[model samples]
Target: MRKYLIFIFIVLAVAGCKKKNKAVTSTIPGKPALTTPAQNSVCISGTIISATESQVLFTWNPAVNTDSYDLVLKNLLTYTSTTINTIDTKINATLLRNTPYEWYISAKQNSSSTTTQSDGWKFYNSGAGIVSYPPFPADIMYPAFGQVITPSNGKIELYWAGNSVGNNIASYTVCLGTTSNPPAIKNGLTESQLKDVAVTANTTYYWRIITFDADGNYTDSGLFQFKIQ
Candidate 1:
């Protein structure tokens, strides 16, 4: 009798543990894929909100296990960013006309704290009397902002990717120094990467990129800083 009672209690405890574990499930949201306002494309007017402002429809494919999403829109010229959260997969946003912008989406789930970020895209907002649009700011690859590195070889490489609507990028200019406003160090660079940049240990460096298009329109990448260890 005693052995049978012990066996029954063990079976009940095992079943109870299984049932409790089965009731809790967690899912991480998948990264949302952008659908409209295609990358490096121009977004025509959707609904004109004002003479200088227009409404743009941003759309993306829904993600698995996603409960909500956050859309980030950045003005390349002013380097200002706005984030909007929604449960739906699309949002209409008011933006300045004749502006360059980049956007990305983030997927979130209530069951998990993890948020997935989608790929980023940039577009030009069309406007009246606009003949040419400035190039979007270059995307930095190495020596990111507030990054620290050890310069064993006393040199570092600078890398970035430039984008434009017309694919008419003329040249790239690199600026580097210690001050907040660095002067142009290299110009007329046809490639995206500059190697063998001299650096010293235990010093901070500031850098930025300037992109010029064939139409003479230019865009400045905001400043980034790095420290050498």
Candidate 2:
């Protein structure tokens, strides 16, 4: 009888151990969700901004949950990308002068997640704008040459010589005015074609051509001043 009692007690203890282990194994917690990073976000908008030979200065709106931003530089042709720098706020990177550089920003929410990429922007050391301005509509050519020919209709027939390099001429922005302050802007044009544009007789118009390369850096032409007769 004593042996049987002892055996029964051991069986009960083993069953209790099994029950405790099962409870602990079934109560495991779920993993936490990953933090979301803001996508492809970058801004250079600010007041009193300028770029020197070696650096650029600009400000942007802060992002939510972002600990910092990653600045990336990419070669337009080869599709090679490199992380040039990381910063908690705006940046002024020392860059090669007069070279075309493509850059963009990505937000780092934390160690876990990052935002989607913001749109890329381009700028030259020569103080050119990032966005491309296509050829002027109603103009004689997409990229108007320095000298123009006046047709019999008393209209100015302008012609644009495309870029000498392999970079395609995306478009041009034709400004018809004396100065840039209040110049009339015409957008979109076919490449390398002559366009007949009407103008007032004996009036001078200042115009320029803005061309976008493959990666979208705009190389602009100096202002071409002409007169209508």
Total clashing residue pairs per candidate?
A: 0, 16
The true-versus-predicted C-alpha distance at residue 132 of model 2, in Å, is 14
lDDT of 2 by residue, 8-34 (tens): 999999999999997765222122221
TM-score of each: 0.91, 0.35
Query: lDDT by residue for model 1 over 121-183, one digit each (tens)?
Result: 999998988878888899998888899987658988899999898888999999999889999
lDDT of residue 158 for candidate 1: 91
Model 1: how far is 31 from its true place, Å?
A: 1.0
Instruction: Report per-prediction Cα RMSD to one decimal.
Output: 2.3, 18.9
Q: In model 1, state the lDDT of residue 65.
A: 89
Candidate models: Cα lDDT each: 0.92, 0.49
- Using TM-score as the measure, the top candidate is 1
Model 1 misplaced stretches (Cα beyond 4 Å)? 1-24
